[model samples]
Target: MNLEKILAISGKPGLYVLKVQTRTGFVAESLTDGKKITVNLKSNVSLLSEISIYTYEGEKPLTEVMQRIAVKENKGQAISHKEDNAKLTAYFKEILPEYDEERVYPSDIKKVLNWYNTLQAKGLVTDEAPAATSTSEEIAAEEPVKKAPAKKAKAKKEE
Candidate 1:
């Protein structure tokens, strides 16, 4: 479920995992194949973490959309991206009813489905919810704290 390291490089064939950082850009290993390549700043690269889909309310993060797909499919691979445009659109609609049809294209839908399948094949998709960090207040309530040693009574300066 860690999409931060996953990326879509423009003109690339499949998903890639961001690896070492370089002076100009960074090294990325193709998820389809273990091939590693250097991606420069000039190369158009997008982290899956930063991608989003247009929705009626606003933009929905790609991760959230992927999660929805996982839930709907019971953590299995989604429909093949190779499916016809109509089918893809319908499936996407079922997952995200509010998706902005005007802004979201069939190609975009295909990419999402493809990505989800790729992630699933790699065993990256999960049914369990992401672990949530407790807020400061919640943490404080859960753990008891010992009182700080009373400022050592200034040793009686009775000299």
Candidate 2:
């Protein structure tokens, strides 16, 4: 399905799963439908590991992170972070044309789009289903693992 279909489903309250594989590891899980979007990174991964986003009609998502941004506004990192977020938001806006601008603030809009692009950049969203294929080398590669001596069958013959 395309972005429109996905967004349409997102408009309702339900559960959806998005399976993805990034450079780091595989991420597969289901999300609870709500008014706002949220992103959560898995354990043993950096900031880029995992993320979630919900629509803005509900409560504000990423409340803590936004608070942190507020506290660290003067720090050098804030400028760079904001710039990066802006880039992400702009990219998202280009892809998601249906986003409600009036309901979404510029900063929040950036966060939502950033979350979406991060998924794309991490190879989460795909236009096609994953394919499994066989190769000549794979057959040979399987021989060794399959050829390990089998255990003796249980003796079941009636005497």
Candidate 3:
């Protein structure tokens, strides 16, 4: 998937939280891959903290790595986290697209390319070129306007 599609679904990958019917009891879950980690509201689950990590093997979902890391090791305490689109964009750029004609669509790849551009513009990811700057009336108010280099001067010399 492209960065935009990822960003659109990023919110879905956080710790699931809910209150029990009593309203006094609460349940929270850290879901990684297909695993479910449950914790109580009164206490914290270090092993259950959910954070987003990026990987680009292209064979497995990012969630798979998360699950592996979760089950193999405690990963310390769980720190609730949401995916940062900018980080995801940088990751995407670092992992060049290997779209095969039979495997993926050009338009799908283009969407990712566009997403990368958007992230770069937002300063979430760094590209070779510096970010573009724009001047508006509000900005011009702060500085004196300079006349365009006088074409007449050059024209007179030519004459």
RMSD of each: 5.4, 14.7, 21.1
What's the lDDT for residue 19 in model 1? 94
TM-scores vs. true structure, each candidate: 0.80, 0.25, 0.24
CA lDDT scores, all candidates in order:
0.92, 0.39, 0.34
The candidate, 2 or 3, that scores higher on lDDT is 2
* TM-score pick, better of 1 and 2: 1
What does the lDDT read for residue 60 in candidate 3? 35
At residue 142, candidate 3 shows an lDDT of 79
What C-alpha lDDT does candidate 2 achieve relative to the native structure? 0.39
- Candidate 2: stretches off by over 4 Å: 1-81, 84-99, 129-159
How well is each residue in 30-116 modelled by candidate 2, as lDDT tens digits? 343223433234333323212233444433223223333333332112222246656645543553444455655666555443444
- Show where candidate 1 strays beyond 4 Å: 127-159
Task: Assess candidate 2 and give its TM-score to the true structure.
Answer: 0.25
- Candidate 2 vs candidate 3: the TM-score winner is 2
Model 3 stretches astray by more than 4 angstroms: 1-6, 9-98, 126-159
